[model samples]
Target: MTTTPASPDSTMEAIGQAVIEGRAGDIATARQKLLDIWSTTGATGDPLHRCSLAHYMADLYEDPAQALAWDIRALDAADSLTDQRVQEHHTALQVAGFYPSLHLNLADNYRRLGSFEAATEHINAAHEHAPNLPQDAYGALLRTAIEQVSEAITQRNTAKRASAPGHPA
Candidate 1:
């Protein structure tokens, strides 16, 4: 019997729900749901699903080391991803645009872990990829965050950024 591929739409919908739960202050439930979904994706499953799942999963943790692990997984899946695949799921999405955010998160995680060298490396990577980001508000936000992380690195401050998405604004 032939196997049917998992639908990206459904995967994205589930991911979205988990993100909403996390945003609504139900991080434990959201993290559990995403973990359940991640079991299906595995390390070799869909790159898009792995990337999105790991990226959000990273945010659910207050521990920098834990976030770093998930962010690394997100970055690895992103390295395996393609613009064509991303565009197929969302016409407006370009894989190039994903690098900036991925690198920024890695930078932030590393900074919080007191790995300033790695944080600088990732922040630089984020800067290099920033031009691929659109001029929209989301892009602006990432850019501002990149700057914040970079400044924090220079200050050798290992504190979590106030502007970070997972943090209370």
Candidate 2:
């Protein structure tokens, strides 16, 4: 019997496998393999996969801003999918609700880029989302830890300003 043609899901699965195995080159190659098929079919999976690949690649590119763009694209692709998938992807992801992982990543990016306000915003969002996390003894320790880090950074800067040579105490 003749073998059936591979589907988009299979292509995505391959890409995921490559990604999981820490084979960035293979991941990109697998993604490109599906790109041609998507281009021919004009399949919606195109953007979804592209967004995913781009997001991963962005991190590897050492550019947080680019990563954010890819994340936005992923969100847009999820929104544009069929009603059922839209609900499953978009609704479940909760654009309005805080997403700890995304927020944490964004927060770190903002911090590195010296955008303290934006970093704090994401940190706050993360805390809001994970209000029940456990810390050493107190509840929601992760949230507390994040807050402490953000606050420490801010406070250190403030103290630096006050202690600057010839500056008033």
For all predicted structures, in order, the TM-scores are 0.94, 0.48
C-alpha lDDT of all candidate models, in order: 0.90, 0.47
lDDT of 1 by residue, 1-169 (tens): 1223334588878998999999899989999999999998899999999999999999999998999999999999999999778876776777889899999999999999899999999999999999998888888999999999999999999988888877463
Candidate 2: segments with Cα more than 4 A from true spot: 1-8, 21-54, 74-98, 131-169
The residue-level lDDT of candidate 2 at 18 comes to: 45
Evaluate model 2: give its lDDT. Answer: 0.47
Clashing pairs in 1: none
Task: Choose the strongest candidate by TM-score.
Answer: 1
At residue 74, what lDDT does model 1 achieve?
Answer: 97
Poorest lDDT segment (10 consecutive residues) of candidate 1: 1-10
